[model samples]
Target: MSRHPRLAAVAIATAALAVLAAGPVSAGEPTVSDPRIVAHFDFDAGQTPENIALEPDGSADLTFAFAHQVARVTRAGATTVLATLPAVANPQTPNIGAAITTGIARAHDGTLYVGYATGTAENGIWRIAPDGGAPEQIAQLPADAFPNGLALDERCGTLYTADSARGVVWRVPLDGDAPAVWATGAALRPTAALPFGANGLKIHDGAVWVSNTARGTLLRVPFAEDRTAGPIETRATGLEGVDDFAFTGHGDTVLAALNTPNKLELVRHDGTHKTVLTAADGLDNPTSVAVRAKTVHVPSAAYFDTTAPDPNLLLARISRNKL
Candidate 1:
């Protein structure tokens, strides 16, 4: 059995999605002149990174998708265990090793937020102090909500997470309120064959953009001045397994990590335009991306081309040049 029960389902669709190549685009971030490998997974402390958050001081915090652990990697590539989250197991199907992502996000002040579940229940979000210690539960979620990707809206002092299983975007105020559904629509729902929907989310330029992993769509929902949600707009369509993405720090372009086909793609604000960096350039199952000092850092989950979990994790970097 694969680590994720859904991987079998992912296999069914991968063959189809993998072949839909992205055409060239002129408007977005320029292709990397040099793509380099910075860190290789030692697989000693943690395994399978689902997301990456970079600290201002150049350290990186990552979530182990199946291991249920939180770790930090320094610029020099040393790993440190921050906390081991409570295991989430399905009481009925205990033997299956599902890689449920406990989404990790870091605030500007260096604090971290994580989300996890014990199978169907005991699901919620946690706040870890800057110094890193035992996690304090911030809010519990619905029994069915599998929180995957997390984003912090600093202006509202709120934390938002993507519920991949239920196609919901949930929110919890930092000041103390129960986690509640922030936004949901047909766009967030998953396709029948592949399971993930509303996989990654971010608060950028007064709008929240979410990627529908199964449906392969990048969606946008405007955040009103009062923090209310506007209508959902299909910013980009036919994105094959679009996962986590980061602002390129150049004009209105972003670098998105595509999982199934194993590549990094540069996307424009219109979402219709794109250019990609493929396996020939050395990317494997890139889960998410973060930008700092004009550099794009990505963490590869290395989840594909094998039934058993792969221990080889990789961190790669790309330097963006101007148009």
Candidate 2:
């Protein structure tokens, strides 16, 4: 389940309608097409997909949020459990209620790196090889920290994790070095109303781009020539409840998941954005998004879905039109 407090369903539905009604649709703007549910998960059994990473073969690797397991779903809707995380003696997680496996990233060699927030000694990042077995903890994050979004920069041999509770990003070296604080500031901090911050992490255009769920902003931390942190920049704003995002092949244009309202937005490079997908299109609190060539993948956890609880993955083709 998501860490943020759930808003009333009526409120979310109303907000979703407002956005959809105002969303712009014109020539040269990218819109979602052929949106369909590729996989339906057992929401009652804790199989909520919190994040996703795409495989080269059109399959998707997902972190089942409450199940504490990683699984793969093929294009034909076949499912396979890749690895199951160990159960914590005490399942109580800080800020959030229970332990969960959140963000995920797949390496070139088919290895999977995932964030596990057990709120116990086991809290950290875990790695699973291609020939999956037991996952090994590569980095031990703070027990109280909630590691949510993850991104891999194979160029720097680093794995960046967004700590939602700490409002900071951790730089975990793939070469076994200790994980250290990568970036933090006011923009990353949470609020009294929203408890989560730094919800998504991605390395794009030589910079680390992150979304702040509480602050409703997307920030950019450019890397210096020496690979140090450059001045922080706010790329987009007014994106409350935004979770994970992926860049379209068109430069810095992005497809971002707006969780609570069950919507997805096409965010342009100039900070302007418009809703492109909505609840009517089968989004049940979409948690993350991934773009693989012309394909867009969105996984809905349905954390706030009480009416007809159905946690599923939706796939759609990204319109070739340049935005």
Candidate 3:
């Protein structure tokens, strides 16, 4: 918007592009084989980035963990903090990061429905006006439940959230009725080894697909015409710490951000999957991904696993020219 902001965006993009020319990938990983880096950003480092929501205009609204804020990033790489969540002090928890703002979904009219870990229904989900006015509470959730990923079906007049703590999925009616547990099964709960069960939620085709971070698996449940959930079926496996993903808008292909291994995977509807990009190519704890045509936007939450709290936000052009 302003000269300084534009220049900052240019500088961040330039630095990322420079890395592609510098070498095959960053140190300590295999060389990038298939998809390569197109653009990246080390923006607002030290603040953990979580989920990203894409705007029709090619911009992305990203949620953070510690900063408790939502930032809008443009195609040109410029960024603006759209909203700051209410202060949530959760010293009793292992890390307050888990209790901060997480999932964010924007309505067609620009109303943004955001999720936070306030542990109170009145404070859990807040709808922020497009003009960025005070947030309005809309739904309630478990005090121990951690709602991380949000998916909105405006046509269905419902919003869905994935509770990572217990591997439960809550469906909230837009009409403001009490939230209902639309889907919850063994697939939704966390395993002993992997304590975080469901992480990301997405509605595609005829089902609501969910990613399990602990089990490193992806599962989906069929949704009937009346929004009834069917059986849970495994979609893909071997994605440990699979945080968030976005449809490539190309057939059944989807791009997923792998957190632990620091990779971007291309998974198809046929159950076939492949590693398209690696951290050696500059990905670091990528928490989530958003797509626009051939361009893929990934945010590295850079959790404690990373030396820094905030890593870089990555932009890459995949081999397949799809969103």
Candidate 4:
């Protein structure tokens, strides 16, 4: 999340301006150059790519928002459609009118878990089979609950999610009952509603690392500690719209996606930070990031544009050593 609370305010105002502006500007074909940017593939014009989950075998599982699609992209960059979401059953559904994939994670056994928000009235978790099967709802939340980011503790078979609407992190057992609040506070609330907005989440080394979108900082919450501990400490600041992140190698380093500036940042546990790549680096509206084998991969999708070209989805590759 961008540490500046004013960015969210500006975003809200910009959203209104965007609506008034109407049509979207044409974006050119994405290209990669010296900095090691690799434009893997593009999605359908209206498909808004969100989070990306890498398969153990090197393929990628991608989520699309307005297009209502989840696709599997092979290491060769071939995209295979997995599923399409159905319309909401209720009329008064909060954010349920549209099914958007806000979070995605893979379990130890290879099953995929996706978190989505619909119409504002319904939010829930869905399980996807590795071999490609229908997504099944495993848990559901109230109208006001909007689940955003997801992470899995493969060793313990536990899943963690940042419930932005409710201002809490929920812990869900893979095969057990529904999820419960594992952490909560004003700091984790949505950007529009809190001084600090919680957008990205990752569980590493027994601690939860969260991106405070509004406050423009990375916060750490020790496992099993009370909220009074005040999120251990802030990781980094001065970032513009840090939304989602991923750990490299053994979790010693992090790669974050900056939404507003459309950049990717590399942050070390020691507090050192550097902009690895930016919009100038060929990324536009990058919402989430993932790293594998020292290679930083980011998904660029038009989040606010309703009529942007569908194939605008791009997977950008950056060398980790450059960071």
On lDDT, the leading prediction is 2
Best by TM-score: 2
How do the residues 1-323 of candidate 3 rate in per-residue lDDT, one tens digit apiece?
A: 11111111221222211111011222222211334433244435325677888889988787866566787877676778888876655422211323467788889999898888655443367788889977777887767777778989999889999887768888988898988888989888875554567888888898888987766677888997777889899877766567788887766566778776677877766555667777676676787877776667888765534243335567776543322
lDDT of 4 by residue, 210-317 (tens): 876665567777775432223556767665567788876544567788766666776666555666676666676677877666345677764532343222334444
- For model 2, residues 1-323, the per-residue Cα lDDT tens digits are 33332322223333322222234554576667889998999987889899999999999999998888999999888999999998887754667657899999999999999999878888989999999999999998888788889999887799999988888889999999999988888888776656677889899999989998877778999999987778789998878578899998778888899888788988887778888889999999898999887789999998887677789999999976665
Return the TM-score for candidate 4, rounded to 2 decimals.
0.78
Which is the winner by lDDT between candidate 2 and candidate 4? 2
TM agreement with the true structure for every prediction: 0.88, 0.92, 0.82, 0.78
Clash counts per candidate, in order, are 1, 0, 4, 24
Candidate 3 stretches with Cα past 4 Å from truth are 1-46, 90-98, 120-123, 305-310, 319-323
* Per-candidate RMSD, Å: 3.0, 3.3, 9.2, 8.2
Q: Which structure is stronger by TM-score: 1 or 2?
A: 2
State the displacement of the C-alpha of residue 304, model 1, in Å, after optimal TM-score superposition: 2.3
Instruction: State which candidate, 2 or 4, has the greater TM-score.
Output: 2
Model 1 bad stretches (over 4 Å) = 1-6, 14-28, 42-46, 88-99, 273-275, 307-323
lDDT of 2 at 34: 86
